[model samples]
Target: MIIEPLGGSYDRKAFSCGVLALDQYLHELANQDVKRRVRNCFVAADRDVDLIAGYYTLAASSVPITSLPEDLTRRLPRYPVLPAILIGRLAVDTRYQGQRVGSILIVDALRRCAQAAPASFALIVDAKDDKAAAFYCKYGFRPFQDRRLSLFLSVATALKLFG
Candidate 1:
């Protein structure tokens, strides 16, 4: 599958894939969030908009060095830097369900995130609900100890798994 960054118009199919109102709102907010870094909005296909399959967005964000467990933080070079990329949203259209589209989107996101490693410690995302949380958990994203809305995976771990 090919994944290309989408912009310049609203993506109704992507909104439908989100599966709920809040998720749709979140997808829309990404387009409106001016403080975010370049939001890579992906639209998967085989070189045509007619083949629009699924989409996701990626943006730069930071996690506190102190939010990480010592095992991960202790190995990093001493600095206050805590680079991260937020997988703001990922959703596969219902027509494409059960065909590994979600997995493709995730691996694509990880691959993109990996390209910025060493400078980044982890990839972070807020799963919209328990189901979305479990999907990410399967890929090794663990919830922050006290934050139900947040989850993260170390860049090292992602590279080893997705590379």
Candidate 2:
């Protein structure tokens, strides 16, 4: 199981995470996002086969300081917005669903966010559903005040976990 950038050699057409939107994104839109310099897509792929086990996208994002808990906001500068890295999308193929493929991809995404250039205060994800929210919560992600499905994990915490 190797994690790498999406490329021509990857079998994108055959990837199916059981979600139509996620499946369509890889086959039809991921390359566009990459080419436009908007988000970088990464895949957890088979070593011997080019099949993708899971995939995720990362991009620069921001969060309103007021949306954070008072305990957290009190420790930071009173900026209107804080820099963040967004995990735009994440999915594991049905064939790989129970094998921790999602786990592997998410951990990789968090590590990348933690080591990103120009610095970010946290990593954020807008979960697609309650199950997705629960999955992210397992990794210590806390919800934004405006939405339960929208969550974030501070880079400071990620550094501690990765280190």
Q: CA lDDT of 50 in candidate 2?
A: 71
Among the numbered candidates, top TM-score falls to 2
Compared with the true structure, what per-residue lDDT tens digits does model 1 show for residues 36-83? Answer: 646667767644455557778888899877677777777887667688
lDDT of each: 0.74, 0.90
- TM-scores across all candidates? 0.79, 0.96
Candidate 1: 10-residue stretch with minimal lDDT: 7-16
Which runs in model 2 stand beyond 4 Å of their true positions? none
